[model samples]
Target: MGAPDFEFRADLLDQSNEIVLVLDPDTGEIVYGNATAMDVLGYDEEDLLGTSITTVTGFDDVESWAEHLPQDEDADHRGENEFVRSDGERIPVEASVSRTTRDGEDYIVVLVRDITERKERESELRRQKERFEQLFETAGTIMVVLDEEGFIERINDRGSKRLGYERGELVGEHWFETVVPDDVEPEVQSIFEGITTGERGGVDGHTNYVETKDGTRRFVQWHNTPIHEGDEVVGILSSGIDITERKRNEDELERYESFVKSAKDVILSIDDDGFFSYVSPASNSVLGYDPDDLRGTSALDYVHPEEKSEAESGLRSTVDGDGDDVTREFRFQRSDGTWIWVEAICTGCRGGGSDDVGIAILRDITERKEYERELAHQRDALEVLNEVVRHDIRNQLQLVTAYAGMLEGDLEGENQEYAATIRESGQNAIEVTRTARDLAATMIADERVASISLRHAVESPLEQVRSAYSDAVFVVDGAIPDVAVAADEMLESVFRNLLQNAVQHNDKAVPRVEISATVDDVATVHVADNGPGVREDMKDDVFGAGETGLKSDSTGLGLYLVNTLVDRYGGTVHVRDNDPDGAIFDIELPLAE
Candidate 1:
């Protein structure tokens, strides 16, 4: 063995911490074995010699491992493998395998170190790293890790999503230079530097705006903690909240404060228990009381006793988020021992982390209240006058109709013609009273309008007028298709007036009138009369009260009623010269879908 010219003692190999073995290069045999190898593998020195290396590891092919052995003298063998101990226990190991020559014969030297404990440590470390990454990815708040130079080292999933970028795109980018808008970067640079360098000491509640990838910016507030290695801060770990909407609301609140500060209206907030929490500055000017006096007091204390219960219920509903914004009008006690009416728009202010239950905007309407009271008093007087006129005049007209019927039974011949005339006059007076009452009702009460057939309205009025004017003939023509008009029960009376006006103004002994209707996108009803026609200058003015034709004998109130009712019902009425010297009225009404 060439005297084994070694620097250390030959027995030192047996004393080594690692397993040392010398084997034949071509055969599956161990030429030599160390004492430590014998002790660990549960084998004697004689038993190890000529033992195949395959029995030490689970693998069946020992030649495959030998193929990886070092071929050059300068290169040292290095690898990881498994081995079996003397008791058949498998163990992991880091190994060195190489071929050498001793006594001009080829041999293999193998060095093995047990790696079971190291592998257990490595596996545990991998599990811990995976757990940390999972938490980082799943965190809701925007989190980022910044290097000492204030560049992004790692960003969590939320940070990347909020900034509108892919996961890996924001990494390695300078936080200040890229994330902040150009107009604000100069001012924020020193502040960011102070945070990173520990000069600022704290970053909690530090607000800044970040420009996103889409060029829109967001307001972000951050809380940061230094990442330390021993005593030195090498980086920073920051968590942030997106506060754009909150900042916008703050700005709006400031603007609102500025506005209501000068306005006559007051805005107030009440807690869940109905105690006033905030009151606007205008409270003093508008209510004759200071705002501070209202705070910490029950919100309904100043309201009239009649309205307090209702206001309390509204406040509770608002706090529970049970309904929409509340609104009410109530009498509020003034500083001068009197009550004034105020209109309030109350909204729920207690949901999604809000602490206040109710917020209200109030405005004084004392003048409007007084005006409404006066109008009500006047309407009562007008209603009494209308009732007296309708009752007394209609009763007097009925008496005339009864007396004319009595005269008709007691007369004969040309004297019968006189009784007939008397009866007609009495009937005319009764109808006139009815029409007068209808006109008054049109002015007093709202139109009870709905969708009605335009053609039907015209025919109904013609029947009533035909009975009143037997000398005249009323003709209704055209396809008379179904067309709807916004009208009420009095709609027929509107046409009745038009037909009476045509006949009563006629100079002809036998007056001829024609009415036609057509349907399209809108319905048009035309009523024409053969009479001394209205003057051209008075065509539009004919719709006005007291307007009459040059030959008209009496009051133009009838046409005025027709125009008023038609216009109120969202229809239009106009007059034109009829064919062959007469007056034609065109009534255009809306066509229902």
Candidate 2:
């Protein structure tokens, strides 16, 4: 080429957007570089001119680059490789090489293009694929990708392990044929078809059973989405979790709810504000109110006016979660506005939620309360009768005995005997009245148990009986043990009645009685009398109501009261025939703790 022609071509190449380089084929040196080449390579013309091609290209030498070039001079050679910049940074580039003859001289022409953005795009695609694979395999739930024809394209590690299969065993297998049971295959296939045909988008929370390799089935909850290529649906991606255990828990909860609904007691829950949060269906039968009607209403509204304060206080402690279980009885209004007694047991829970709630179980106690009321009335009436006998009857009997005694001294012969009989009968009647008074006092007493000294209990009654029966002899076998027993003021009456019975019923002229007591785990007292021995069959019936021992005309209230009081103190009393003659009354009482 002429110099003008070479200058024109060189100037034209410099103006081109491409990075152009002219090289010496044999030397592998850059003969010329365009302006674009200098700017992209980060170098000036002086820094690049005459530089060896190996400095910029990855090739080691001229012969190495020649081997990759096209052998035909007319053909162009293309390559994708990196170029080292002046600043020592390497960037990817595309290169084209061709050999041409100018004025019979061989020369090489090379064109280069920067491809950093394109290479970055490729790298980003690889990174996104890796991230997707990591998420798909490591997910907790089963994930699967299926083709439009229902073939398994991909199954995650979790899905394969859950189905008892190796990593790639499920790939390329028909999903329904391999995993779905025969009974539900047709139905599942229909849904899959809808997804692929665009008739339905996908499934959300659809449940079905999947058979494993061992033929055991597991119920799964599925959520699926369609995978689209352009405007056409190509496949489906599904996620599933085993819901068998959750279903069983739900069934148990349902059964428990049914039981609560049919229970006879009213069950309810209360919030922190003392209002009812939930009420069981049994409220209708138990409290004469509908469950819905009771909900959201204050529980204290139905309580009796006198009991509202106690009810409110209990509610506060329970909802605050600071109190133990509480059981209390109070009057509650029925649906008809009449009051009925109810017993409520309430409990609380801590850390349950924002407002820790309380639960109450209420039962009707109206029948028991009514029975208690009737007993109170009967006791009051008996108390009035007891006062009448204690004063009126005893005073009248005393006057009759005094008048008969006066008559006895004045009369003679058979008249004197008649006066003595009248005096004795009046005295016996007076003693009977005292026994009756003791019985009445025992029956009406509340809180009837206390710790009593055995020694005092026996000594006081012994002295009284000895003074009353001057003709009878009373002796203590040994000193009475000074032990505390579980008894009350009525305890003295027990020994008094026994001592009186021993003397009054004696057939001997001089009645001899011996009292003794021993203490171990309990206090046992024995009262032995030297009298006609009681029959074995009558011993048990002696304490029965109206069944007197040795005296049929007398009321057996004294002996009966002895049995009742002993029982109240957690003790027992029994009569047995003494050795040779008379009877022994044995009383065993618990020791006071």
Best by lDDT: 2
Candidate 2 matches the true fold with a TM-score of 0.58
TM-score of 1: 0.56
lDDT of 2 by residue, 1-593 (tens): 21113565778888887788877777877878889899988888888988878888867877897786665588998989999899989989999999877778777888999988888999998898898788789988889999999999999988998998985789999999899999988878888999999999989998888999899898889998999999999999999998878877887999989878888889888887888888998888778899899999999999999988888778778877776997778999988888989999999865546453788999999999999999899899879979988999999999999999999999999999999999988988887898888888877888557888989999998898898789899999989999899989889999998898888778888999999999888899999999997787888788887876564346777788889889999999988989789999999999998
Candidates in order have lDDT scores of 0.79, 0.87
- Encode model 1's per-residue lDDT on 158-191: one tens digit a residue: 9999999987898999987778888778766766
Model 2 residue runs over 4 Å out of place are 1-263, 304-330, 347-351, 354-356
TM-score of each: 0.56, 0.58
For model 1, name the residue pairs that clash.
41-86, 56-84
lDDT of 2: 0.87
> What does the lDDT read for residue 12 in candidate 2?
84
Report each candidate's C-alpha RMSD, comma-separated, in the order given: 12.6, 11.7
Which lDDT value does model 2 have at 224?
89
